[model samples]
Target: MPDAQKMFERITLPRDAGLPVSLCNVSKTYRTGFGLPVHALNLVSLRVPSGQALAITGPSGSGKSTLLHLVGAMDTPDEGSITVGELELARLQERERAAFRSQIGFVFQRFHLLPALTALDNVAAPLLPLKVGFDKQQRARELLAAVGLSGRERDLPSHLSGGEQQRVAIARALVNSPGLLFADEPTGDLDSRTGAKVMGALLELRSKRGLTLLIATHDAGLASRCDRVIELLDGQIVSDSEG
Candidate 1:
């Protein structure tokens, strides 16, 4: 086990627990160079109970990524508030947000692994900067193996298949044993069959770890596997249903 495994285990991964997240009247707007406004989210509000697996499905420009970004604390909304457990995202200062982010894991549709790093190093990257008491490489190894990448730890991102790279991103996201995980198009870049396998692995990991999962994806197959699914249109929740 890595130091992070022990150090943050109690803080992040309590038994049968995950961060409960909520948004109230959340809105985001972006302006182009010409000063026209694009409303990403308009008065959006939702509640996700702890350990619930929720999916966000919508077409392009439907505010899927914007919602994730706001909930993930990567960006702030123009109005309203977001609460996760006891913390309010809009109120966290820059430095506080950085520290708060350790409890959150995000996997983008595009695998953003550093091109120069091997799979192990990429997975171990987040722990390298922390003062953890356990071996970081060992933690990385365990995560890689959990994602069915035990023997390929030495492969660089460019050398791996699309699904493998996505798994590596997932491994990296879970390296900290985050209480919450956000995945945008978790399987978008893979073949339908491969995408299904990757989503299965992600959902299995989510359940095994008791993580509150939020995923935004266009693939209906991917969305249908979650505990709940909400579809977005023009930045609003058009449909919320059981997945």
Candidate 2:
């Protein structure tokens, strides 16, 4: 683990004054089954400005997903820090981290929706923890409509197309109005046409809501659509360029 202060110096700060998300010298290492150490991330640093979208691209085992977990606070780094908004994630307690994570929406490659739950219920899952003033069901319905699933609110995952299910997942992700959205292989299971639709929904969300988007994927076409493309190799970011 490198010293955070020193690693901070190495990161080139973006021009944006208030980047919604940042990672400084973030590293995560694990022991392989063979007892050899594997470095999933090595002194990785990044800053995603507010309302910007960044696509993380790499070959398999290149630590793209690991970087997402770090930024999403699903896991802590072995070294360095990740900050979201004004919050320093490394300094938060476990409960606080959980709460903070609720403010971040995650779309998994597998959808991860409950088979028994309808699209509406699936989208409402995040609001269970908030207990806010609004009606969760009403909010979920609105989100589903926004994603073009207005008539399928009662449909279960089994009944929807891969694209539709993914849209439901996106609605679920945005139900909380999260400042950041983390998507992993968002269109991995769909055809090119369906994938384009999913990307369209994401792009619409970015432009309409100004939501910051980070997608971890191996798809070059998808990565090229984002505002910036970051390449990961051997658990390190080798290149980052504007798209």
TM-score of each: 0.92, 0.90
Clashing pairs in 1: 3-134
Q: Write the per-residue lDDT of candidate 2 for residues 56-80, one digit (tens) a residue.
A: 8999999989998888888889999
Mind giving the per-residue lDDT tens digits that candidate 1 earns over 1-243?
Answer: 655444444334343577899999999999989999999999999999999899999899999999998988888999999998878887776766766677789999899999999999999998886877789999999999999999999999999999999999999999888879999988888899989988888889888887899999999888999999999999999999952
List the lowest-lDDT window of 10 residues for candidate 2: 9-18
Candidate 1 off by > 4 Å: 1-16
The C-alpha local distance difference test score for the whole of candidate 2 amounts to 0.84
Clashes of 1: 1
lDDT of each: 0.88, 0.84
Task: In angstroms, give how far residue 74 of model 1 lies from its true place.
Answer: 1.0
For model 2, the stretches where C-alpha displacement exceeds 4 angstroms are: 1-19
